[model samples]
Target: MDLLILGIVVLIYFLLTGYVGYVAWRRTETSEDYMVADRKAHPYIMAMSYGATFISTAAIVGFGGMAGVFGMGILWLVFLNILVGIFIAFVFFGKRTRKMGHNMSALTFPEFIGRRFRSRFLQYFGGAIIFLGMPLYASVVLIGAARFLETTVKIDFGIAFILIALIVAVYVVMGGIKGVMYTDALQGTIMFLGMIFLVVSTYYILGGVVEAHQALTGISNLIPAEAKAVGATGWTSMPVYGSPYWWTLLSTIILGVGVGVLAQPQLIVRFMTVKSNRELNRGVLIGALFIFVMTWSAYVVGALSNVYFFRKAGMIAVEAAGGNADKTIPVFINSAMPEWFSYIFMLTLLSAAMSTLSSQFHVQGTSIGRDVYETIMRRKGDRSVLITRVGIIIAILIAVVLGYILPGSIIAQGTALFFGICAASFLSVYAAALFWKRATREGAIAGMVSGALVSLFWLLFEYKKTAMALGVTRVIFGGPVISSMPWPVVDPILVGVPVSALMLVVVSLMTEPPSREHLDKCFNGIKGV
Candidate 1:
């Protein structure tokens, strides 16, 4: 009976999703409509869509599971998510981005940056990076959602992975950004309600909020010796300052994702989806509230699960999941939550994965077809949309392949890797384009290339997780890291972002300034000239 009920709910969800896609497809006609939804999205849709796209299965499943291992210290990212991802992104970046996008008639993020600098190389280079790098992030999301389905629905992981990729691809290819946002609004609402229940139910099960936290604090002595050696003070407390674990949490996990959200091509393009600055401003509270509930619930519930599991099963979450942090949330839900709630939470997890995956595939498609192929070929019109659809298909295939191969405990770290690289490669130049008229094309290019290379080098050589994935340390150096630096665990963003910003400043000072005409158009609204 429970299986039957779950099936009925899932089927209805698919039908509604397809109907929404059909409506969006009917509305989508021109390239502008397909790319940016004609820049006239409503405040509610815009806010919810942005929130949904920003918070993915990576947050709820991957990071939630991470909380199971690392504890509530991950809550710092919640503060950063609200402050940087929503507040600063919408207020400081959104207004300028919307105006500049309109002034330049830019469609995609790469196109915006490219036109801002008036450089085709930067445009193509940015597009290439998105095409190459985004699949890893997309794959991690796929793995996250698939893992949940595999755990809950008794589905094969490979089958679950392919189904999600295909379902998202169909709507995205047919309806474009309009369909993506339309579906996202619905998904976001589902996610919000589901997470609220999840958190409330968790606290209820743990006896109460204060009592749950107190139980969690009581288990500080249970910290594994291996974890303690690396500076884990307790599940409820931050790691010892400047310890190896602290660097991983602060530099790699928190800072990498917190700072990196600013430059994500998928999220940045959202600014171009609205009609005016007013709509962006209107979304501030809704977006903030949505993000706060979703993230806080995940971390708090994940931390509290240790108490529940230890009391009931005599094992921690990671141990229960067979040492895979990615599996902790699924194990907890299946073991702790009632069957009915599990079904609802399954939809929540699906919404989280689908909303994020749809945006990622869309951005990747646009990067290739509109930013790279169309620009290089000097083509336009309906053919470009067709090419973008094809690109989406190809990207889906690549992400599915990656989902099958990625190692255990990779979902959260993999997400941070992608975000960190985006910050390193694009954030400095992107910020300069928006707010600094003195920034030169040479500076943008220099910053982009240097930042990208430095980030890549650090990941392959210095970051232990990525190096192990690449088999660099094992194959080449026969150890965890190639770098002999005192603090080897520090994330690449700590180094790459600084170097990228410095290069941007020095190169701009040395190079000729952008033309008066370019500056005039770029700052038209802001300077009132």
Candidate 2:
């Protein structure tokens, strides 16, 4: 009975999100509308879209899984999430992006940077990196949401992933950012409601908030020797200082997402959609409040799930879930919630995925359509728009296929890896473009190339399959094969982000700045003349 109700809820979510897509399609007058909603997004819509892009299934699902293993310390990421992601992004980056975007008349990130520095190479280079990198991130989010749906609804993983991807792709291709923003507003609402319910109901099921904490903390000794031998401690307790787990959390997961947000092409562009700094400022509180609740709840509840699993199954939940780090959050949700919640939970998961997926699909599609195929590839301007449409179709197909890749790049991702790469790779030039008056075209090129290549090089070397083939766990980091590190999860952001930033700053300093004339033109829109 409960399953049937949940199915209907899932059906309704698809219908509503699809409707937003339809609205975008019907209203769109040109390719510009399709790519950036003609750059007329209001304050409220922009804020929600920005929020949607930030908090996806990764936060609730991927991070939740991490919290299950790492405990509550991951909550510090929530603070960075809002401060850097919402406040700094909107206040600092958002204003400049919108102002300079208009000044340059640039529609995409690549175009914005390309036109700003008066270099087509930067445009193509930027687009190429985004095109190559975004799919991995989108795929990670896809897998996170799909895994949840497959478990809760008993749907096949392949079918669920493809269907969700198709639905989001259609809307994105049809409506562009306008469609994405509108849909994000709706999806963001669902995310808020769904996360709150999961948290509240879990608390109720555990008899109360106080009792849940007490139960989780009391079983300190239940932590396994394997866990203690490395870094695992009770969820209610902190990991040992300087432990591998702490470094991974502080450096990779936390720093990766927190610091990496400034460079995300898709999210960075949202700041350009709004009207003014006042609008961006208004969104700060709302964005922060929503993120705090959604993420904080997921981590706290994930930590407390050990108690729930212990009482019901006589073992820690991770043990019950087969010690697969990814399965921890799923086990908690399935074991803790009643069947009715699955229906709503499915909505939460889908909402999370679509919010991010739509942005990725659109950004990737437009890069092909507008940036590469048209601008750099030398297609005529009018013809390039047509190619962009075709590119959208192609990009969608690529994402759909990649959705089924099983995220083998690491233990699991679905799409999270791409986000890290995107942030680490692009955030530097992006930051320099806005904040540094001395940014140069030569510096931009070097920074982007160095940042992206260095990032991918690090990942390949660190997790080289050749090492695994030779009976080693890591190729570059080099250690034992069978034993776990104090930190089990290895995120790519920590390695990649700082290198990208360093490359950008150093290269910019080495080269002459963009001509003074260009700086004056770029800053023409600064308020009050």
Candidate 3:
């Protein structure tokens, strides 16, 4: 019976997403249509796409598990996510990105950065960086959804990974950005409801909030000193201040994914897909509400799952699970929910992965095929739109290969490396292009170089926690600076974003601004386009 329900839900979701892809494909005419949905997206679709791309299986699976260990401290990240990731992002960044993208005929985020400063170097470098960093994050998301299915349906991990990847690739290759956004709306809805149901049910199963709190707090007196050192305070409140779990929460998981939203190729391109400031303005509230529920519910339920396991089942889910925090969410869902409800959660997890994976695939493809190849790598007339579809296939294959070779530690690091690099690499250039009229090409180049280099070195050497997370074969620098210190030494965003911003200002001042005529070419089309 449980299997039957799961199968039916999967069938409906696949068909709905496929229909959306077909519709999007029918509407698409040229490469621009495929890459950016011809810049004609409505506000609702734009808002949902932003929401879907922002949250993924990693949130429910990896971070949820982290919550089981770290407790409620991770909630601070949920707060920042809606504040910076959605509200500030739309009001501050979205409108201008749309206006400028349309003005310069840019179809992808990398193209936007390159064209804004009149530099192919930025375009090529931006594309390369995304192509490199996104795969690790992408692979993590892939494992997240795959694990849910493996637990619920008794499928093999390898098989689940392949099927999910292929399904996402099909719609993305067929329909482009419109397909991704349409599917995102549907998937985002399921994710929102799934988390809400879990949070509500978790409270009931644990005897509501008050009882759950008592049971959790009671354990504090009974816990071993070792358990306390690892940062469990009766599973009800935040972790011990500045424990390893607390430090990871502050620097890597919280600070990284929250600010990193600004530079995500998938999310940034959503602004470029929509038509006007009005569209972005209308999209803001809907986007914020959806992300808030999705994040808050997941973390809240994840922390409470500890009491469910320890008291009712006598199993410490994290300790029993071999210290792989990513598996704890799946372990919770399967145990807490009925076998049938677990199926619904499985489909929800699948939808989260697919919606996010499709956008990442689409963004990577457009960056490589249009922004890098035709504009920079190739020195001829524009290539056919079919080339991007081909590029999507190639990109997925690369991600799959990396996923197969993926390490357990890198999965734990979540989106930290990518966020730091993006903030450092493009945040300043993006800010200058949108806010400062005195922005010069030299300043943009300097910012990009400084930001990218800083992120690379920091992630490689100073950030020993990230290296330990990767579980790599070789440690060139031997490990993190302060293993004894517990936290990441220099978070890439703190190190790189400031350097990127300062470099942009200093270089722009040292050099002349672009000629007035050139500046007009990029900025004059505020509704003029």
Candidate 4:
């Protein structure tokens, strides 16, 4: 790689991104504009921004590498991402969220829920959860970007981490959601084009799509003994039923991320950014296609890299990257792709990373500042925006520090962990707040608290992977997990969401329903919707 050429290309990309941020910053005149883009974003910008923020470096680098290790079975997540994340989300959740948010004059997700239920407690609790849990997700995204730069550009990981964090933090602190979404549109375009080129070039390099699939399918014997023990089948097949691999893939990766996306603070807020259902309807096809190309291409190219690695080095993708699935895609690209293509792909990863990170930082900021601080202080104005800027900087610092501290091959695990927690803690209450007019504030509180507790308990005592990582169970119970086999492997979302939903429904029916006037206000303009 030519240092001067790389520098010039990166400089141009930064300048373009900075220009977009500057425009957004200039247009932002109030907290509403900063927090929700003034609720009048274009369909194209909303769709692309949502998709870009949804599919981050976590998808391409983290989960893409997991596809290399787990095989094409991980492709199921792509299907669910389109169906649940985009289709159901836009059609069911997005439209209602938009109307209700507007009705409540809510600028943030927590604020939406809070105002809907007439509970300041809900607002602050929700905001506190996002402020605390989001850093883990943000940190993994930072790691994915830093890892790519270190692998492809030979930049020091520390330097790359600081540069990426600083760039995203600056724009997010200044431009707010407007800045975040504008740059997301630009970054999303780069990611889409790059992934198209990646998948096409990968197939061309390996003979053809069919040949590549066949080549990958023929290497079942290459599965390591340990993997086979855990029910590894092949790159083309799903893991065997009841096996640890099966449990982790189905419950953790596929279901956790797929279902969890619906309640994501950063993503849910995108629905509030648009003005009406018309924009969301127009955005459906665009968001779905963007997610399909970005995710499908990553998984396909990731799985096929096995064939390339096996043929060239007599090793599978994971082995080629020395047992670190997180490095699989990076190693494959740098070693197999043309020199010029590597530069283009580098920007693709950077776009994916920055777009998502900006959203994360912005949401985290709003959670602590707009939701928590304003609710507590009983105030909202310029101070909310200023406090949000300070919160963004703090979020960036925590994420950068975690990016350095976390262990290797943690990209996918960390992503799944955070997504699962979000789904468990917020999904049930969020859904009820949107769709269930009979739901009481007490019920919502019960659901939220129960869901969060169950999720925290599962992470520390039942889910073996996270339990072992945190060492809470090990220290307290003298083992990594309290339960046996399947319970240890099962995801927190499975148990927590159900418990939460059950509590909400049962408690709501037993308690006094919300006032008719409040329900009328929330459902006003959402009757047919």
- Writing each residue's lDDT as its tens digit, candidate 1 over 98-120 gives 99999999999999999999998
| lDDT on C-alpha atoms for all candidate structures | 0.92, 0.75, 0.79, 0.93
**Per-residue lDDT over 1-529 for candidate 2, one digit per residue giving the tens place of the 0 to 100 score:** 3766766776787889888878877888776666667877777777778888888877777778777777777888888888888888877888888889888878888888888777888888788887877766777787778777776667798888888877886777667788899999999988889889889988898889899888888887898887786576767767777776556667666777777777788887786776567777788888888888888988887777778888898887668667755566666778788767777777887888899888877787778767787676676455655666666676666666766654322322333456567776677778788878887888777777777786665455452232244434454356533234422345556656677777777877888777888888988868633
By TM-score, the best candidate is: 4
How good is model 1 by TM-score? 0.98
lDDT, ranked from best to worst:
4, 1, 3, 2
Where does model 3 exceed 4 Å of error?
Answer: 221-244, 377-384, 409-412, 469-489, 525-529
TM-score of every prediction relative to native: 0.98, 0.91, 0.93, 0.99
How much is 344 displaced in model 1, in angstroms? 0.6
Which runs in model 4 stand beyond 4 Å of their true positions? Answer: none
lDDT of 3 by residue, 1-529 (tens): 3667667877887888888888887887777678788888889988988898888887778778777666677888888898889888998888888888888888888888888888898888888888767777788889888877787688998999999999999889888888898889888888888878888888899888888767766665544467677664656666677675556667777888888778888899999888778899899899989888888887777777777777766766675455677778887887778877786787779878988899888887877777667776565333635667777887888878877886653454656667767888988888888888798889999998899998876665557665555544135545435344643544778788898989989999999878887778777755432
Model 1: weakest 10-residue lDDT segment is 479-488
Query: 430 in model 3: Cα distance from truth in Å?
Result: 1.2
Q: Rank the candidates by TM-score, best first.
A: 4, 1, 3, 2
Point out the higher-scoring one by lDDT: 1 or 4: 4
Please tell me which model should have the higher TM-score, number 2 or number 3.
3
